[model samples]
Target: MVCVFSFFITSCEQNETIEAPQTTTKVAKKRLFKAAKAAVSKSKRTPSTSNNNHAAKRIASIDCFAYVFPITIKNGEEETVINSKEELADYYDAVEIGSEPEIVFPITIKLEDNSEETITNLEELDDVYDSCMGEETPCYTLNYPLSLVQEDFTTNTSNETVINSEIELHTFIDMAFDKDENAHITFKYPLELTLSDGSISTIENDDDFDAIDSYCYNYDDCEDYDEFDCFEVQFPIKANLNGEEITINSNDDLEEYISKLEDYTFPDFVFPIDIKYTDDTLVTLNSLEELEDAFDDCFYEEDDDTICFDITYPINLVKNEDTENTVTVNNDQEFDAYLDSLIEDDYLYIGYPLTVILQDGTKKTIADDDEFIALEESCDN
Candidate 1:
């Protein structure tokens, strides 16, 4: 019975046709959080060591151009910045650069870092600027307008003088004297003169200045005056002796004058027997006897037959205690031997007056060892 039912179903299925099911096509959906997960993973990764080293090298390097700013050159109120070649050229033209510049002004240098430094004067600024620009020497500005304080000392009739150097100072002095011939200069303030060798001479007071000025004014006149006349006038017949005119009349008067010769000490005796006239006339007598003879000749000029003793003794020896025993020595060798004997015996040590007549008919009394030695040396020579 079961076999017959299966055969009946099979026969019904074989008669029925099987057809495919039909539906709308659909695409697979993508994960929405995938991009966000990848981004978080990338953020958690460690930076490379090479990248860190590169950053440190960049921080260590210095930028010289950025830190260094253009220099600004200043003179008084005028100023200019030197940065580009054009700017430098413009500054040179404005300043009118030249070989030499006299007036120097203070300069101010500014940097890009907002820092500033001041150069004391134009010379110092020139040195720095020239060095920065690799110049061999300093650059000077020509004919820069400069106002200066000037102290003038010159005559109205003479040319105007400015005291700039020592030479100019001398010119100013000449001009000052030319203006007023009798004007006396007094330096109230101290003046310092520097020589070429760098020595400093200071005129501190009015007295020194006056002395120098007087010397300068009287130099020519003093040079023209005869200096030999001074000796003649100083030793006149009735010349001033300590502000008193002393009269030397006769032999007795001359002897008294010689006794009181206080002008010179021993070994350097100054005899009062000599008289110098204003005409450079020198009159000297050897002894009192000669002076008496000269006086007699002057008194009896008309009496030619008066038998005046006009004989001049070549050498006369005078002894102090034994004036009667004094002798005249005519022989040169004899006088030299006598001087040698005196020196050998040291006779000058004894207080005995010994005088000798010189070849020029002058009497000199040997008073000390120096005189004795001098006589001895002269005789030996």
Candidate 2:
């Protein structure tokens, strides 16, 4: 009986010893997995924060231009006024890590030439910012042997291509777009990327790739029309500069004449001015409206569905030549309501001498019905 009890106690002791290591191993694996997950979460990049920091850094280092004082900026729903460079710095330093601050539109910026330009939108602000930064686009060296799947739109078929170099990758993307603007390319994941810091990071999927792939657009090709391809005003042009007749023999002459003009006064060109296109085509512009039409022929020839300009309110609107029944539209809601009130065969006219803000942030004044009609026709094209 003594031997049996001793044997049973020894068996229990052996079982406990064997189970101890297994429990410890399971707990260790759980802890390791939790730690790994936490590390991944911490390392994932926040694109908004990254972009905001980049913008802030660039703005702080800007030397070519300065923001107009008492600029309004917003973070989420909260707005703040930045009165000086010191205040801007403080705001940048104290802004929440993930919060993005947007500059309010119509803020004026002082250029190096002492000319102040009112930036009407984020695109205008970006143009100024890019000019100050020397128009640098962020790009990174991508690892080779990356696989891309190209799909044929007509046939609904796909083929895999292994890109071995950056040039090859660029050529492939360009060729794809050249064939069809709607061409689709799917990147095979688990590819590695070499960051600016010379660190290698793996892209697991499209989301991961989108986070770091910043070279998504070309700065030079962003504009609808190439400035060089646009029509050039033939020299030795006659214009009434501040109501005084003057001849601008060259671009320099025009500049000199413009410099002498009083503030807010513009040259009224004597019609019919001649313009030459790059293709050796000559167009005779009968008036300022016709000159603008020639420009529209070059710029708005593309089939763009988006609205290219915005009218500044409160613009006066008159329906069917009823000058006494003029209505002032102050906002988009009012403008929409005015449109809804219009019926077929009802002629609507904007009260002359209104301002329009173009897509490129240029402000132009419409003098009369003819100029306004020309402007509307250009936008429609």
Candidate 3:
């Protein structure tokens, strides 16, 4: 009886030892899970099922140009009460509205790429301007307050040209659009007498804007179009810009988008997506709980096991796995929203944030974060 009792105790001890590692693993997993949940709660990348999210994600917006004036108004008439830059900064501190006058230039963006673009416009930007005030499509209403409180008066779009006597400022404004000559924009800058005589600065309306190309869009050539047979006439826009030369693949569908906008009319097409489970081996998912009905509709990238790589910006924008969430555009403009991950359920739109174009016309991509505001802060008085 003693031997049997001793044997039973030893067996229980062995069983407890066997279970120890699993218990540790489970506790660690729980901690990790709690940590992940906490992290996601604070992150924008966290996907939610709230109805508010659906309403929020619906894309709606329109673009407009606004002019800023140094003068102030109580009802409508210009008041000379607040003309100083210091006061303007506080009054129109909201980046969406113009407390000061600016020469606002409006742009109509036509999404040439079939897949949804990754650029996202914020609600604060919406307060800048509105298209119309009705249930009709693209209705945000004109006279919507367009202001940028965080940015400086100089960087503000509506702010008239200011000549810096203390320092020479060379800036470039990057304009991204379909490579169409007809897609030209003309606006007279309300330059003060000082800037007109200062340095004879250059105004670049040309599209072959820069050589620091960071975009590569590949598509098969279309048989419908004439095969490399054109009469001797120089099509103003360059076929390609980056280090890589332009190569239109045979059976290409997008070639026509780059065609002359003056005559060519593009069809309104839609892209549909289907969702499926890619095993963890290929497209990795966080958490041990496998996603049931795992994915929302995805584009172009198939083979769920394979990482879905889709372009978000100009051309074939690539999305990699487990990297910093970024939107990279062509390094051709000082201010371009090409790389923004724009998610919306309303009309898409544009808002000019901080801008600093280089003399050489090299463009930089500023992430859609507070860092942009920090840059704007440095320029403010």
Best by TM-score: 2
Top-down TM-score ranking: 2, 3, 1
**Off by more than 4 A, model 2:** 1-228, 304-381
Candidate 2, which ten residues in sequence have the lowest lDDT sum? 39-48
**How close to the true structure is residue 195 of candidate 2, measured as C-alpha lDDT?**
70
Compared with the true structure, what per-residue lDDT tens digits does model 3 show for residues 1-381? Answer: 111111211111111211111112112222222222221011112111111111111122222221123433232244334443344434332223222333122312222122222212323223332222224432111121211111122233332222121110100011101122111122122121112224332223111111101011122222242321211111221232222334333223233323322111111111121212333233332321211112111211232222212112232122221124323343322111222222211122122232444234555444433533343334332
lDDT of 3: 0.23
Q: Quick one: best lDDT, which candidate? A: 2
Give the per-residue lDDT of model 2 (tens digit) for 6-59.
121111121121111111211322222222222101111111111112211112
Each candidate: what lDDT?
0.31, 0.50, 0.23
Candidate 3 residue spans exceeding 4 A from truth? 1-203, 212-254, 262-381
Candidate 2 vs. truth: CA RMSD?
A: 31.7
lDDT of 2 at 256: 58
lDDT of 2 at 165: 50
Error of 3 at 294 (Å): 16
Segments in model 1 whose C-alpha atoms lie over 4 Å from true places: 1-162, 195-202, 206-227, 230-381
